[model samples]
Target: MLVSHQQNSILKHESLLVKFLTKYLSRVDSDIYFAKSSRCVTHSFTKTATVLSMANDGTLDALPVVGLAHNDDKKIPRKRVYAWAFWDWATQPFNTVLITFVWVPSFLTSTFFLDPDVVGTAGEEVALGQLAANLGAGITIAGLLIAFLAPVLGQQADRTQRQKLQLMIFTGLLVLTQLGLSFVQPGQEWFWVGVGLIAIGSVFNEIAGVNYNALLVSVSNSKTVGKVSGLGWGFGYLGGIIALATVVGLILSGVLQGDSALTFQLVALGCTIWTVFFVIPIFVSVPEPKTRQVGEKLGLWGSYVELGRSVKRLYKEARPTFWFLLASAVYRDGLSAVFVFGAVIAGIVFGFGFTDLVIFGIALNVVAGISTIIAGRLDDRFGPKNVILVAVFGLVACTTAVFVLVDLGTPMFWAVGLILAAFVGPAQAASRSFLARVTPAGREGEVFGLYATTGRAAGWMASLLWAVFIQLAGNQAIYGLLGIALVLLVGGVMLLFVKAPARSPR
Candidate 1:
């Protein structure tokens, strides 16, 4: 009877070992396997039908999971990084070709021409006031709507698994709106159409950008994020240069007459194509980030609630980022105003024609791109803050020169304008990298949303102020631009007081 009990005990112990092996193998399979095992049965089992068993197990778990990995430093290749950067390249054609180079300038000189009586009354004081007013109104309306909606869209994107889908939708909207601009003609009606398209496209572009920026964290490691961001901006400038060259070539060769509306239409079409093709890399290389809250959803109203909650959370935890946003918004708007007004100032003050303007555009693009590349390296080494401060100071000096020294036939206008363009690239790129340094993981979308909001919020202020300065100071648009310089200088000084975040490389 005692012998029979020992045999049963041994059978039970063997069965337990099989079950343990089966379960372990099922859970880990080829990714992990048992390296070794040992089992012991006490000699007392035979003497008294009392059994004691011990098992030692070892496992190899150094295998990759299907969609997950253990390494903390995984990154997409540099080729993919370049491809991702091209998205910026692709969209910039719209800014260069349609908005700045072809449309606004053409409209002001042609279809929106002031009456001789009004022109005489104003006495070369046109200042593009009507155009500026229309632009300001559109931007203000868009800015207000975006301010209410941007954070909500950002929150929804963060909480959902459909971020890539959201990006695609907004990208589509941007492309469609840009393409729609091709239908605009040289008439009063077309003026409103162009403005509407620009406003809507701007909104969609901002929304798409929020999702697109969020995708960067998944593609790059922390160490290389600044480089990738700078590359993207540099590529954008390159794309603008190419598009500007194409349009300029067409116009100068008389392939598309400057007076023909088709010239502007073709430029708009070019922008649409550029936006569509350049974003291809993003679709191919960047994977959608997985979300923990899959299948849980938020309605449009829920998105707003989430935004409110995010703001409160930001208030509690992101005070420094908020301060940075306030300063950045004012300064960035100043930067944009300089660009927006530079061309008009060149045309009115220096008498730059289409060819001259195109050449200047190319020069700015090349200089800005080079400056951005250099600034990125500097940012990685000496830090973005220092780069930004130096660039801001440069801008201040150059703008002031444009205000105080640039006159008709004055060499200073061209010299100062080119210098301003050179600084624009580095300053904008460094600001982005600076924000990247301060932002925590998983919050890029929210912070960049604030970036966009602040940029748009008071963006009209600079233009309005410029118009006011032009009207009141008469023939002193330079003084208005100089005033913009002062705002930038003040922002830069304020920036000096803020402490760099602890996580920043510097």
Candidate 2:
């Protein structure tokens, strides 16, 4: 008896089909329920049914705007939609500039920070290795905090309907932390300062991501979520490319003044500015979602209890998604390590010079951007499960190639390393698509927060294994590839046990 959305006649029919499906979806008392298309989720009979979501053609007819106040604003406007997508475009520099391509391994691991007191006693190699290990430790500790807090924060945002507000606050904190990097000059005195700032910036970045991801449901539906997610992810990689290009340009034009430390500091400042100016459109264009009708907001302690119940609820009612989170968490961390340690591997194992590495990084980002966008389309057509399987399999093969062919020189790296890079974004984007498909409608924020938490839960595994492999091989770093590949392979194998969500048609 659900009314059809007037936007598309085809969707009107689809809505009715979804209404019929809803009868089954609402039977939570059953052992489990499966819905087609991740975006078509509905919550109880009282919540909005995203029935007219995905279609056979992959493009969706616009549904009612999530929080539009005006009756005439029935369709999702193009301007607003594009503005919403720009958030990924704006924040790409954090990943590309600070994390992946430019900052951490290249500068923080440099000899400039070696303590005068320990330079001789500790040995330069030992000192540098400790810096790298210390950085990873900081992130691990941060991950634990995130694992504990993200769900709680997300639960609060869902009830209050302030997902965007949460995003902006953390984003602002991230910018401030990025700005603090300017104070971290050379020598032991300032090394921990740099590490602390990056760790804190990472926290702000991740916590903000919880709200940013939840916003996906507000701006998109089943039909377009895959491509939109792709677009955001693609833009993010492209943003990193652009940020790195700026660094290249600065170096070429002599704007960086030949001080490597100064260059990194300037790059961090530029990334901060990029995030601030670009994140404005979402606030200006996308309104906060209407508050949920799902009872009173729980207190923080109660939210944890509710989260436990929610997990139990999901286990009984959405078993595939519950297990999928556990599986995806492990692989996603491995995917992250591919980038996190890639530059290090290239520098230490394959002997890539700074310029060689930077150029290669730019090329890698370009590949990731293109691959993620294409895979988004694939995600829409073949289902996210299929896309993820292919990407992860490709990752395992390509990563193994990097390990097996370590003796072949930079040419080997150029070939298989780029292949390794190509699969990473697709796996990441598809996993997000996979989760969105099964998540109940009203709880997008909290569930996506769980998505972030679970992903962090196994955050230590790949990094720990990398250390283990390196030590086992008598510190021959090439053996570290096996560590990362093992995690991805195990995680991918787990994905096989997770059944794909049923697909709905328009």
Most accurate candidate by TM-score: 2
**Predicted structure with the largest lDDT when compared to the true one:** 2
* Model 2 weakest lDDT span, ten residues long: 64-73
User: Using Cα atoms with residue i matched to residue i, what is each candidate's TM-score against the true structure?
Assistant: 0.78, 0.84
Every model: Cα RMSD to truth: 19.4, 11.2
State residue 139's C-alpha deviation in candidate 2, in Å: 1.7
| Pairs clashing within candidate 2 | 36-502, 38-437
Give the alpha carbon lDDT tens digit for every residue of 1-506 in model 2: 00123125323433553354335224421211111232323453223223433335534321212221111123444445556666877777776777766677667767768877666673777888888889878877778888888998888888877788998899889889988885678877888888888888888888988888877765555555566577678767776776677677677777674357777777777777777767888889877654354546788899999999888877765667689889999899899888877777999988888788889999998899878877876786778889898888898898888888888988988999788778988888888777766676567678888899999888889989999999999998888889999999999999998877544342
**Candidate 1 residue-wise lDDT, 351-410, digit = tens:** 888778778889888888767865766665666667788888899888877776765454
Candidate 1 structure, TM-score to reference = 0.78
- Alpha-carbon local distance difference test for all models: 0.64, 0.73
Q: Give the TM-score of candidate 2.
A: 0.84
